[model samples]
Target: MNQIVLTTLNARYIHAAFGLRYIFANLAELQAQTVVREFTIHETALNIAEKILAEQPKIVGISVYIWNVSEVTELVGVLKQISPELVIVLGGPEVSHPPDLPAVCELADYVVTGAGEKSFYDLCTQLLQRQTPLNRMIEGVSVPLPQLASPYQYYDAEDIQNRICYVEASRGCPFKCEFCLSALDKTAKPFELGAFLDEMDNLYQKGARNFKFIDRTFNLKVKTSVAILEFFLARMDDELYLHFEVIPDNLPDDLKEVLKRFPDNRLQFEIGVQTFDPEIQELISRRQDNQKTIENLRWLREHTGAHLHTDLIFGLPGDTLENFAESFDQLVALNPQEIQLGILKRLRGAPINRHTDEYQLRYNPVPPYNILSTRDISFSDMQRVNRFARYWDMIGNSGRFKITLPTILGDRPFERFLTLSDALFNASGSTWKIALKRLFELVYEVMVGTLLVDSEQSQTVLREDFLRSELKGRLAFEETKPLTKQKVGKGIANKRQKMHQ
Candidate 1:
């Protein structure tokens, strides 16, 4: 029986829990007695409890996050009722701070906060030896970069083959963007590069084709960034795919040169252009060179083969719907592969809370804690933006409406799209589960009837998009054409990849 179990509810099965593996790897002498169990939110609390109980764990450590916190809270409550003697421990960003803990924290027997690897292991050691700590909250000890063991070796054959192989060459972010939990970090610190690469090589040799780096500022150190890229270049196969989150403004010549060498769709950069307004940037202590960011985005699109996935957050303290729309329009013009439209959430202990009063920020008070309303944007407008984001995912970002999107968006991208988003929701009474064929019809109807576009133009363009989408069925505007098969595997890793598959 496993004496110590490290577990977490992943958002999806495809995501192997990277943090749980790190803690498991560092369990020291307790490694033999410990096991790592992962579950997803989709599973019922009773089912998760049954599997967890089967292990007969003495101390159960659960890694909580914003995505799975509510379900985890319910799971923890279930565990407490069934196994009162079980020592429940909670550790993760969700439970880490706010001296004011949530219901989950109160239910947990012990809580370890911040850089929890070493601290958790030590707690297990103490508990297993029949000596429990006096206080429930334990301050996590930060191990030096060189001293911390590489977590890559923990990935098994199944994980490497099926899930996103998450690897981090470093920890922390230098920027103090108030909305992000990473703003609490003092500075960015790199692992010993040689050691880190050695572990990556080990992973690569074992058939890990997909490597998604968890570094906050990957391109910050040009030398380090180039070395990692060069390592992948040495083992360049058509299957080798890498994902990095790079600082939008900091693409040096050395990094770009290496980046350009990679084949198209082989590299994906998640660029965070949270806001284009300088006032919001300053208000949030975000230091983005907006001019440089635009230049780099345009350059990446023009020069490199990298798939650019950019982000824009709607509800910052001072941001208005009009300015947010302007930002959306600006980025739409650049034409990234995907635009992750986000609503700002109040993360516990995040410095963004400083503006809660001034901005009249009201959050959902639930798991994600997404802003319900802000001083600048009304609740009804926020709901409209929410619908806009949802329908945009189905239509705009799906890349299925390439031919018709430009016409629908026209000169004012945000306003025009907002109009369409409103009409789609009003017509369909949903932003979800609309079949591809049905979506095409909805867009066509909205274009011709609501937006008052030319019937012939709408039908022609919508039918072209429909044909390109390669659906099986025919629409009213369609003439029959054979559909082309979609290809997906081994290279690109986005949430949208499933549709093509």
Candidate 2:
């Protein structure tokens, strides 16, 4: 049986299977029989090989990521060994670069960079027709296409509704944020706006309401961004919501007026205010007019009902932990819906590679490759910030920010959690499952004691978080058991430890 298998190492439990869904839907449109399976990062080489062999696929495509490349590579090796005739293809951000992508090219027969919707379909058609492989037909910086498909290939609504649904009105970013992986290419070409609106209509019809535009900066093109916002605003209903990553300083007054007309929760903006320090910003090729960013942010808060999600990064060139904390304090005073704290992830292709020595940044030599701040922010301080990031994710992103305990936790719980998380991390000895389980257990206990007045909702959300966290652990099948309230907590903790260890 001729078959196509597309898979990815998932980001988390709840994320809709995007790449596979896209490819499968495209094939369905072409009236082709196909199967798409997804696995987590923990799914081993043997595990993947067994699944592929079982499927007896004619074609196998694996979506690669920085975190999952090693495992994916091993999987590739095993699959090739078992059946060298299997047509193996790789794609995604991890391979969206020059032809000399040693890591990707070494593992697979073909590397598909950039938007794979049209290219992937063409490949399938050729393979079926007994034509030569159309690897060169794929398009982007590395390979230019004479024709590219309309940004069709519907993102699965069922898969995207619960987690953030990422839609791209455009590709590429105009910014030069050195640390930003998205900013690698500066050509920001948008899809035809009307065509984009049509896609949005289809998605909306499919029951997708929460959308996060994958545009590097949604507001870079004032008129285009405004048009899209107006279109959504015209269609606004209680269930419709949109999130954007915008440059705070560039926000227009007219846009402010438009935003003010919506409910506070109708729109959300994740502003990357990586640092307030001018030196640091310039050093990292991030040129935000700080004064303008501040003014624009203030105006956004005062004039608009849009919920704000701001971000700050630790361990940038000159940013000490103390300096980052100061920035954090300032952001807290602004009271965004959430303050996403991220450490600098040294992605292979980011411009930050050029400045490793200049910044004196020492990083972990493994997956995620986060930096340990230099003299500006000591190793201890980096640890503190890491703990801070965990606490923020638990209380802030988990939607527990409204509780009184979050404030209490914000006041002093971070320090204690940091200590405990560190100790647990050490004891668990790189077993992320155990460390996260212990972290979640402690965080939940603290929240329950201090802020979990609404136990019913908190418990529901916490359990969901636990399920997502489970995706991070080493994979082992346990038959689904009926969970009792009394045993749920213990069961979750035990499962997490099992996955990690």
Candidate 3:
């Protein structure tokens, strides 16, 4: 019975459509006629189209992102084929910029770029009223922070119980990190504190526990950050977990004091230590104090109970394998819970595009266009690092190998791991669909046979890691058969590393 349908293919089901809710909240009189539906990329386009057409929407709006762009393009094609008159509106970061707009954006009946909460409503109203604009693209005008409606009220009971709800106290980032879309924003903008907190309390009372703040820099404003932390702390329980992306060097004593108040593992800080090289930092107009970043990371590790998930980019204008390895080793030495190794991507409108020719950069020319090669790093070498990142995630970040990781990383962490990565790929031949039990057996074999670690010590720690994993099985390497039977080069080719696509 609804005339307007808002939909998107979410990367995962647990991620509720935060943007769709914002647009839904501001729909005004059209609110009653509208419905929001979310699907995952795992679904086929025809299957998703069937569900959307079931709504009989007069105008359909699809939220697009880099991860889902490829699937969504297929969705748009199918929708047009089946329902030619069905108005299709596209919006979100993937469709916001032109010149590099993907095929799906071009196929959309209308595109709303930038902040779409208000703009989407305006476009839908015009469409339904038969006052459609001649121009296909609509520029999304920014609404004042106070005037912007809170999207939290749209979360139903199911969302509150099962999903990771996204909330933002502010919009935009003041720092001009050239690789990010937020760099295009003039400055950070905060919503009215009292009103925002009221909405948060409402969400908490309604059984929402997992909150992920989408603000680009949650720690940018010390007073605001402290207030939010204290608010959550006052209502803290074992079930309440919060996540925030904080600037690496900006933790003051005030922030630290509040951070210390939070109990263990309740808070996670995604610190952006993209690269430790000053030259690369300056190249991308990323201003970070490496010394303070190191100091703060060490302090957080020692003084606080928060889990640290640090980031490092593998490919950049000035990055070479040697320097990136140095950055990787630096992060390993700090001992964060997770070291996210991200490959540099050419976001459509990001200022990093200016460095293309000088760096000899080659992008994949696909969705989530990651850098394939640079002047200093060849394509083959980049692929090696790509595989290494996947292996590292399974071994280092998964917390499965907590007992044996230090032994694997050793003194020259990156060098040794890269060597192991090469050997792993050589043994397995591909890097996907690796069974957990099989991976343990492979790692045990590699450590004992390929890397030539002391067999007794490697088996001891690896056995501890296996026990900790709680994965019940007799490891192929640990079978009752004689040592000669479990060969390292045997059909363990079943699994390797797949760089998270």
> TM-scores, in order shown?
0.96, 0.74, 0.95
Instruction: Specify the poorest-scoring 10-residue window by lDDT in model 1.
Output: 492-501
Write candidate 1's Cα lDDT for 283-380 as tens digits. Answer: 99999999899999999998977888899999999989899998999999998877889999878889999999999999998978999899989999
Q: Which one is best on TM-score?
A: 1
What is the Cα-based lDDT of residue 468 in candidate 2? 45
Q: How big is the positional error of residue 357 in model 1, measured in Å on the Cα after superposition?
A: 0.5
In candidate 2, the residue pairs with backbone N, CA or C atoms under 3 Å apart (3 or more residues apart, or in different chains) clash, namely: none
Question: Over the stretch 357-475, how does candidate 2's per-residue lDDT look in tens digits?
Answer: 87688988766678876647788878767865875565455443234334334554444435444544444453234444455555455444544335445455455555644434321
lDDT value for model 1? 0.88
Regions more than 4 Å wrong, model 3: 479-501
TM-score of 2: 0.74
Clashing pairs in 3: 431-496, 431-497
The segments of candidate 2 whose C-alpha lies over 4 angstroms from its true place after superposition are 17-35, 42-51, 97-105, 113-147, 151-153, 160-164, 373-375, 396-501
Q: How does candidate 3 fare on TM-score?
A: 0.95
Alpha carbon lDDT of each predicted model: 0.88, 0.67, 0.87
Tell me each candidate's RMSD, in Å, in order: 2.1, 8.9, 5.4
